[model samples]
Target: FQVKKKQFFRNFMTITLFGAVGTMMSFFTISLAAIAIFSRMNIGTLDVSDFLAIGAIFSATDSVCTLQVLNQDETPFLYSLVFGEGVVNDATSVVLFNALQNFDPNQIDAIVILKFLGNFCYLFVSSTFLGVFTGLLSAYVIKKLYIGRHSTDREVALVMLMAYLSYMLAELLDLSGILTVFFCGIVMSHYTWHNVTESSRVTTKHAFATLSFIAETFLFLYVGMDALDIEKWKFAS
Candidate 1:
């Protein structure tokens, strides 16, 4: 994207803050507003905690769609913001949903809110560390084992496998798999990428791109088809 390092970092921070803190704030706002509106209208009674859980569920942004729309304009700041927010949003949604799913509205208090925020911060930081460490370890192993000096196919396979491995391990450890994989990708690109043979590097790049394009194409196609079902159309009305 040719974004300046400082600008990229600043934008990344902004989007990340939106993803984490912004999502939490949005959840609370939506919950309170929905409760107020419903109460005023004398609608069916709803649990505040349940409404908050719904808010968490909807906080997840589709980064793929955001990136696809923004990337065409060559706007690095907007692209970075959308991309970063989408990533963090997914992780935040997961953590927030899990934390609030079993929560009781009657137990709400200032101390509980503080503890919830504390848990979210801790989870975010720990998951990030797990991802970076996995990437670093993979890079170190590839360099020490001289995998790149071997067959290009083997190098490519090893790198791709390690990336998936990080995600799996993160899930096994009850960390945010999405964030772990995200950081793993960043680390692999920055560190391990330089260690690979030129042939393997090109191979990996093209392979990943082709696979991603195909995946996204089919994913959207399926979504479109799913949405066309008349039986499920009542929700929109």
Candidate 2:
């Protein structure tokens, strides 16, 4: 257990460092583009707020349902590193976005710094704690219910339903709902049984991974088209 945790910590750090570097590189490239758009064309200047919002939303990296996939087996170290970093940065970006929107750069002070730190700690700890507690509770309920056991098909269905419901509960609570999904996977990890039981677990994971992929793909494609349409409409106006 200690060894695995140590590995987890090392993977987390390496991932975070790379994430920071990637964020810096992304900012630099975006800065250059912003400069070119304003100087080399008729595009007007943008304020700090614009940069902050864009930076916040775009800075987040997602690994889809990779955590579930990892729970099925020993995850490759690189996968752990990258995905872990991406998840953390997602919340950080959102928080930074909110902060920048609320206060101008010139107004930043020690109080603002404390507020930012407080926000991060609150979101991170609450998201994880709620996710884990709910996950464990749900798992215990499922185990005692005996509804999914003995029947492979029923068990897979039960897990899927529970995972979906867990995410919804987290969202309804105004928490990081996706983190709940991650915790669901983690709790389920503790319940892994024999060879046959393990296969059922993998099946459910694969199902979620597939569904999440399709959902993300269609959502992003549609959102991209909507964005383009808005851009064109703005130009006409």
TM-score of predicted model 2? 0.67
Instruction: Please give the lDDT score at residue 216 for candidate 1.
Output: 82
Q: Rate residue 68 of model 2 by lDDT.
A: 42
Best by TM-score: 1
lDDT of each: 0.78, 0.61
- Which tens-of-lDDT digit does each residue in 85-150 have in candidate 1? 877888888877766754667888998778777776666777788889988987888888864566
How well does candidate 2 score on lDDT at residue 21?
58
Off by over 4 Å in 1: 1-7, 37-46, 146-148, 233-237
lDDT of 2 at 158: 70
Name the 10 consecutive residues with the lowest summed lDDT in model 2.
1-10
Candidate 2 on 159-209: residue-level lDDT in tens?
667767777876776666666666565665555222226667677667766
Backbone clash pairs for candidate 2 read none
List the candidates' TM-scores in order. Answer: 0.83, 0.67
